[model samples]
Target: IKDHLKHHQTQTTCWDHPRMAELYQSLADLNNVRFSAYRTAMKLRRLQKALCLDLLSMQAACELFEQQALKQNEQLLDVPQLLSCLSGLYQRLEQSHAHLVNVPLCVDMCLNWLLNVYDTGRSGKIRTLSFKTGIVSLCKAHLEDKYRFLFRQVASATGFCDQRRLGLLLHDSIQIPRQLGEVASFGGSNIEPSVRSCFQFANNKPELDAAMFLDWMRLEPQSMVWLPVLHRVAAAETAKHQAKCNICKECPIIGFRYRSLKHFNYDICQSCFFSGRVAKGHKMQYPMVEYCTPTTSGEDVRDFAKVLKNKFRTKRYFAKHPRMGYLPVQTILEGDNMET
Candidate 1:
């Protein structure tokens, strides 16, 4: 018990434990049980906030760091300068995130993520390009916008990325899941497989333009799935449905609202849905639709019709035919390196 307590104290991140990976994956799977990217992203954003790991917005990060007058993509910030910048970011975070009251601990975790993702060698210095890439990858922006911004960071003057440039982008993007302790769910930290998959998707071309890169991104590669999910989360950040959670009885369901297709007027709040709670007869396997925004009259009628249809479906049918929420692309390397 003494040794266990000591180990816990020494651990830096909340997800440093072996079980944390499984916990995060399970939570993600549970939140996205029906395979909606928007739902999955909302859960992750909640988790990120709860863990106090959601860093500054892209605009805020740019404002804070851009003031340094450093050369674009060529300058470097050593440990002291990096911490100073993080300190400023933390001050802004504290105003919004109440959980970030612990200034030292929060700043330390933020610094750790930045260094682990951008300064993997622990040289105590990070390139301006790497820093911007890391911030943009984790920022609150549209997934496609983030993708274009990241690609621009690595792309040549002709707006093309060679194998080496693509590899760099993947390397930095993978670190978000790594820092969140969810890297194992996304195929570990190795970026080679993801890079190879991208190039192969582009027909093994020597270089890929923005159009080719966007095509691959649309497939939702395992390593970068979180980016799209983050976008969904941001979309629904302020959404409030005019409904009550059947289980928890919370009014005006905030965030993603889940409405049952099998039952009339049955609604579940994000909290109840995430906790796997159900009312009297509603089963976990029942078909339901998620809404990040309020439903219109037409959408309500369409959902009602779908619900009436599902009512005729048997329990066995639902069990036999499970629905997938997202179609994640599995690369050739993934198939070759099957665990079992």
Candidate 2:
């Protein structure tokens, strides 16, 4: 059964499978049954198998179990006890995002996010459903899949989320950029504006359904922009372009390939670009287009045209015409404030 499931793993996660629903329902039904350690462990093990969880997830679960066992001073087997084990998950999160400059801050923000989303009562305890939903939302899946999963977690039985639920999602999402130190680039850490913008985009509906939620996500609201960027960065990590870095002189530039719009055939490797290294003649302010994937022939032609046009322009013209890499969304509230 495991091997058969593994064959289709690429196409679908266990969460989306019917068997998962059955397993989840069975686990829930266990709550009504009398407490039995053997029964509870067997149910949990089945659910874990269905999740196809990685070593880290399994290890985290084990740690949580140990913590609960030590603290409870009893061997009562319950679903809540199994899921409430977040003792060492923070350290695991830190290790996963080791590239982050302030991993501790990121982990702290994530912990707060968990508490906010799952433990609304501030009781430090969360339901098994909440625990599974939270972990699945943060799993290394497609970005859209994660978005859909998160929305469903907060959505009503009819698959709709009111303003408050949407706000919760946005608030939790903004913490990613906040911890990465990229929140300022999109907008401040305020989530209210983003919620307003989303509702406005959804035609001011009383409750936003999945389709509306997806549409808003497609716009990539300021507060949640960092997630898409993170996905792009991850996708580009192993991407190799057939261009040479003019500064580093590395052939077949690996990772992000940055092409200068001002200079013909000028390219910079990801390392050089991040370090702010420029060749002798190129200025730091000169506009450059970033490519996570390799450029096509048509793109090469278009870039050539852009470079030709830029070459004729004066330095002052280039300075005055600065290019932004991302689309900036101005909410109605912000615009109204600007007028006031």
Candidate 3:
């Protein structure tokens, strides 16, 4: 099965051309591989239907298992645990679902079900920690011999298996639905909402060595893992040992600032913060603070380039103000006092 999956990944099919082009372009590489479009489309259509059937079969299996467990008065651990139950449910579905002429491998079917659960209410591929935890949890449930072998192939004790690794594991065994391409398009910024609860922000840059990443994956309540802080540290190390502002990746004369307690080491120039610059996770409500300045007044110093950068970066702010010609004319007869 592993050999078959490997073969499948390397095989060229018509449906893959578009995605292959996109992938190759992203890496600035290309190949002269050609394939029969009509034949590939037909194969893809069949594969698509097979994938849908497998999903429906698994969903039915899950619902049936839940009903039986409920009748037995047994309480499941958590969403992850409930999902791990897919391993036990697949066997029952195979025997009952005669219409499923093309049954995917048991492990592939179960892993796909788990992936569906992890991707719920979020976009992008599942991160390494969540992926590793889910697979290990399923293995602990005591799956059949063949199923255990497949799961172990994709899992490791040292670290998480990324999507590329998973793709290789299941590539030939089952066809990935086109919908997966759309989900992948959403990217990392659309991480699962519950997963976001795992980390808290910091006021200063963080130390994100390999050890720190492993500890963060342990999900310890007291372990403080600030992503922004780690990002700053990584950027500094890679970009010629200089820490660029998070908002504008340039030198910070006045220093960077951040407002969110949920964020750490996420520095932005004073200009970007005060002028209402906004990005994916950061917003205006978070307050800003200055760093490495001798005096408080120096923190407020706004450079010309920084100010201009903020103006363009925050066009939405300028859009709200009315034109100067529309200003209300002040009347001397008004009850309110006016200075001349």
RMSD of 1: 8.1
Which of candidates 2 and 3 reaches a greater lDDT? Answer: 2
Query: In model 3, what lDDT does residue 91 have?
Result: 47
Write candidate 1's Cα lDDT for 1-340 as tens digits: 2332344347644223333444456564554343333344555565455335455566676677667654466578875666676667667777887565566555555555566656666676777777777666666656787788788878999898999988877876776666554566676788887888889899999999999899888777777776766765666678989999999998998977888888899999877876668899988767678787888999999989988998899989766654423333232334311010
On residues 1-340, what C-alpha lDDT tens digit does candidate 2 reach at each position?
2343343345332123444445556665434322122123234333323333212343454455445453322123232242234324544544664443243333333334444444444454544444544455344567677677678767888999999888766665555434323456456677777888888888998999988888778655556654555555656767999999999899999987889889998999977776568899998667788887888999899889989998998889866754533323332333310000
Instruction: Point out the worst 10-residue segment of candidate 3 by lDDT.
Output: 29-38
List residue ranges in candidate 3 displaced over 4 A.
1-48, 51-62, 65-84, 99-104, 112-188, 191-340
TM for candidate 1 is 0.66
Q: Which scores better on lDDT, 1 or 2? A: 1
Model 3: per-residue Cα lDDT over 118-228, one tens digit each: 544433234333433333322212222323333334444544434343333333122122222212211222333212222221112222222333333333111111211
Using lDDT as the measure, the top candidate is 1
Off by over 4 Å in 2: 1-123, 126-134, 177-188, 312-320, 326-340
Better of 1 and 3 by lDDT: 1
Q: What is the lDDT of residue 168 in candidate 1?
A: 75
In model 3, which residue pairs have backbone atoms overlapping below 3 Å?
Answer: 201-262, 259-287
